[model samples]
Target: MDTEDTTGDLITRTGFHFHIRHAEPEDEAIVADFFKHVTPEDVRFRFLSGMKSVSHERLVEMTSSSDARRVNFLAFSPNETLLAAAMLAVGKDPQRGEVALTIRDDYKHQGISWEMLAHICRYAERHNFKSIESIESRENHAAIELERDMAFRAYTDKDDPTIVVLRRDFRP
Candidate 1:
């Protein structure tokens, strides 16, 4: 049986609602669409490098890999449409971790990102991780604010201009 981490319910904030669930094989298509909308430009902004697309095979590997270092999750709307996604990777230290979150373009500024991050943070905390980090584009102030509100320390290097790292301590 698939064991659930800490984030096993619907998270509601403001006027929006989303649930975090383990992504299954049946979700491949919507997940692919999520990545498609994620786009080369979006990837470049998030990664600070151009990426055309993430392959389906790579996603499958990320979800089921025995490494257990990473796990995939989907944020679905009340109507069951995907609104956002997050992949949390547990590092070798167990106390170190990283996360990536994406919101559907059509649903921007609808509180989807906030709910997703909250769930990710809660999940990280329950796992005994010391911190969870986010790498984002310097221009994405909205994301920066979200991270800040979640109590993360954010850094953007002038030399590296494009990527900002946001770190939130998970250990209490």
Candidate 2:
């Protein structure tokens, strides 16, 4: 059962199914295309920026895997349509990692975000990160509630009043 959960790239939960894989540089084009389908508001919420569109530089950064401490995962529907993308990046503090995820607006509320986030949390745990955190825009109620439902505690970011840090700490 454990192996089944860890090894398979396919996930089916709550009557929804999607394939997930570690991202690669070659995926830039598809990711860019996927973002084009995402709503501007969703993009702002995901990136915490007001950019009307995702830039080529940002796409390249998201698709690249040169950083050993970071891993980005991409999700696709059974028919090969991109559904979502998630990132887990561990910084100098090895015990803590930051997570960011976004789902195509059309796919929102179908449990894709929840499933993708849960998977990223599991990855962080396995990697020995004592805690996982995400910085979310204060206006992003949907994401804040989702993270809270997953046992993440939300707190205002000290340096930025416009954002909140949602954190889930692992038990030693």
Candidate 3:
């Protein structure tokens, strides 16, 4: 099903109009191509490692999941060009979920990330999750600040000093 905002507005920014929908198995290749367009730093932040390339297995893990706990969302331009991707992985505890997002390098600073993140949070809430969490690298200042602006509390990961955990509670 195609997901739309409450107002039925297509996400648009900087002259780009996008359709956001839940990703399917066929989108594995599309996701791979999207990753190829991102910067190396983005890859590191997404995978938490400085890998030279995203492996097929990893792409499969992201796009084709039989597990109901995971959901991947993809944003496409009017011409169907992949613009960004976000993954929501709910833990065994139904009350919480982890989210990760990456935007095309060329789409950065255009509010796509912000819109995608808001959509993810709404998705989590609709799924009855009380909170959402994101693990971000300390060096990713833009994302860190974005999360902060979104009201997600940031704290250093005890085991990984290089990582910061951001969490936002949806419950009152």
RMSD of each: 2.8, 3.2, 2.7
- The numbered model that scores best in lDDT is 2
Greater TM-score among 1 and 3 belongs to: 3
Structural RMSD, model 3: 2.7
Q: Residue 106 in candidate 3 has what lDDT?
A: 88
lDDT per residue for candidate 3 within 1-172, as digits (tens), equals 1233312125645755677877778999899999989999999999899899999988887785465778788888778888888888877797899999988998788788888888888877876789999999999999999999998999879899999999999997
For residues 47-128, write the lDDT of model 1, one tens digit per residue: 4666687677866753552446777778887788877777788666778788887777788877777777787777777777
lDDT of 1: 0.73
The lDDT for every candidate, in the order shown, is 0.73, 0.83, 0.83
Residue pairs with backbone atoms closer than 3 Å in model 1 (clashes): none
Question: Local error of candidate 1 at 150, Å?
Answer: 1.0
Clashes of each: 0, 0, 0
For candidate 2, the 10 contiguous residues with the lowest summed lDDT are 1-10
lDDT for each residue of candidate 2 in 1-172, tens digit (9 for 90 to 100): 0122332354545688888877789999999999988998889988988898889998888887776777778899989898998888878887898899988888877888888888878877776779999999999899999999999999888899999999999975
